[model samples]
Target: MRFLAFLLFIAFVLFAIFARWFFICDILNLCEEAPVEVEVAPRLQTLQLTENDSVLLSGYDQFAFSKGIDQPELNTNNEQFLDTLAQMLTADTTKSLEITGRFTPQEKDIMAGFYENMGLARAAAIRDLMASRGIDENRISLKHAITSDSLLQEPLLFAFALNDLPSEYATASYRFTNMTYSDANFPSNSAIFDPGEAFRNYADSVKVYMEAHPEKSIRIVGHTDNIDSEKYNLKLGMRRAESAKEYLENLGITSAIETESKGETEHVASNDTPEGRQENRRVNFIIE
Candidate 1:
């Protein structure tokens, strides 16, 4: 029995020496496993406003959304970053934010109520979050883009600008055109001018011209349809012109702006039809 016990002990020792490696390498398969790669998080890029002006948002990555989700999943650091942005906006009243959300074509497009697509909805969601953090909603605009990159790491992009939208209507030579006031342009019988994307281009050109030739001045001639009395139309037209002038001035134009009212006398279209009347109610910007 003692010899049998000694034999068992020998067997146990042999098992521990020989079987241990096989247990780890063959049974567990740990020896065949490859080294896991650590993924580095993407850093948030700086927001460039101009040649000299830029906003550096350190320690924050771009916000990302889940598949088919409009709301972004923001982290604690993201909240802090937004707080800092809100404070910056509060201090500087002349700056605005443009949030552009990007999406892939392969993803299903989901409409979030008024937003036509998930791209726009994502942008609006971020804008609303910023607005909730004390930034004025009006100061924030939303844009969306479709990307072919299905592997886009981060989906949202941000742009900080000088409180003005980039105009696409810039021209080499200046041509004075009608700043139409109608359903398509401004509210009926109101001085409020909601400048379209095209109009913004013209406004930008005006600024460039004023900067290049400081001696040049602008003349805004306001015209109206024959819906109102002559005196009332004249007043309305003058108000329209003044509104345009004020808009240009806010765009950093320092040149003098003279506003006048042509009333219903200069009707480019007939006032008989709705479309013609709409066409007639406009202001012309003449550079002098």
Candidate 2:
């Protein structure tokens, strides 16, 4: 019995030794196995997103529906819409757009505390644009930028996505003929001036929206589209900017409005193409 017990103890020692060796070998293998690439967190490459890429289309309901106007029928005799776009394009554009603070019922539409205000503000802007296009001055129209969640979830049931409606007209259906921003050759100015003159009902709408807010102030700047000398562009930019300013001033808003010109320096678009050049020659507003 003692001999058997001694033999068992010897076997236990060998087993223990083999177990230690196995664990040591495993530890060594783990260290050699590609070092587990302690992955440093990947650096984030930042990029900018602008208004053009946004998919939220809420603004104009009638215009988004079958009744939505892509472009107004050119007033053949007056060409009011084209002329309006032109004036808007020529207006100074150094300033970024501004919207006045508003009295709110306390809901936002974007990333909280801003989404509703922003959406309502945009809708108000569309209303102002329609007004610029000749709505009855005494009557004010109101609509919600929001729709029933059911409308969004079951678009077929609601028959339309409210955002699909345009705010004034389809931006896709523009009616202007000449959109160049050069002093080398200017097109004949229309006999009568359109308040917007070019693609600027948007700007005017913003101005009008600010004015509607009553407590807020607004300012605007203009710039050229790089079709001429910077000096000439600046001066030209001022004329159109002042023109817009004066128009707003005449709307019984004398003091809170300001205007200036920035020539061709602060362009939001490239001046390489006719389309882009048209975009660059413009005006914008700042609000407080």
Candidate 3:
């Protein structure tokens, strides 16, 4: 009996030790685990603008923007860089500037009243700002790209190349309002469209319009470039229209939806260039 009592006491002591350790470490927060390392995103250290294989503006702070916004937030360094660039362009008469603005798929086309996409809006905004800074608006060309970087803080990417010089002045207004509607663009020979923030905003606007006109119905017409046979293109266009209809239905639009296909027939732009073809492959929303 004595031996058993001693064994019980030993077990109790061990349990007490473990219980105290657990109470201190787990309950009282006195212990720490291994520190976790976080991965940081790489940022651009320099802002560069080149022309005809030569660097014009270099070693400036990268231009950044607020998340989901098109307006660039310029710091003192950025302003200085711009002032220097304006002076350089004034001195050099042969060189021209091209501003290519970038936008992620998540950004909305808030400047739909002026530009077709957020990327174009951003580029135009920069061009107008430069114009106000005494840079010749005729010497600057605006372009846009759908950026691949999901975590990109700076949405403007700059590069230079030779292009035909024009004498017209830039004429884009700075005011912006939320996009009420936008065309859903598709990739080459693809029917699926990315229902981005612009699409969501358009759906919301449609919902409002639909509530006011309950008897009105919605129509989605899909168009395609001249790529394949007429029959095949028609079928592809129909698929594209159906895809848009599905997106609208998922976005809580209860109005009657109609789908049509105008394959390679009605195009807003010439189908000669790749950019034109991309623009041609789109689905337009119409209220009927």
Top TM-score hit: 3
For model 3, how does the per-residue alpha-carbon lDDT over 1-288 read when each residue is reduced to its tens digit?
A: 999999999999999999999999999989888999987554466788776577767777777775667678777887897788778777777767777788877764454424667787778778778889887676776656777777665677666544445432221222221221223545544677666555665677778878888898987777777878889988988898898888878877898999999877876456788766665666667777
lDDT per residue for candidate 2 within 41-140, as digits (tens), equals 3222221111334422222111111111112222232233223422432352221111121222222222111112233333334334535655421232
lDDT of 1 by residue, 1-288 (tens): 999999999999999977988898989887766889988555454322221255456436667677778887787766776788788789988877767777888664454443435676787788788879888776876666677767546577676766554542211111232223233457755788777655676677668767989888888888888896999999988988898888988899988889999888877556788856765777777777
TM-score against truth, every candidate: 0.42, 0.34, 0.46
TM-score for candidate 1, please give it.
0.42
The C-alpha lDDT values of all candidates are 0.69, 0.40, 0.69
Count the clashes in each prediction: 0, 27, 0
Worst 10 residues of 1 by lDDT: 169-178
Q: Which ten residues in a row have the lowest lDDT in candidate 3?
A: 171-180
Selected candidate, larger TM-score, 1 vs 2: 1
lDDT of prediction 3: 0.69
State in Å the error of residue 189, model 2: 6.9
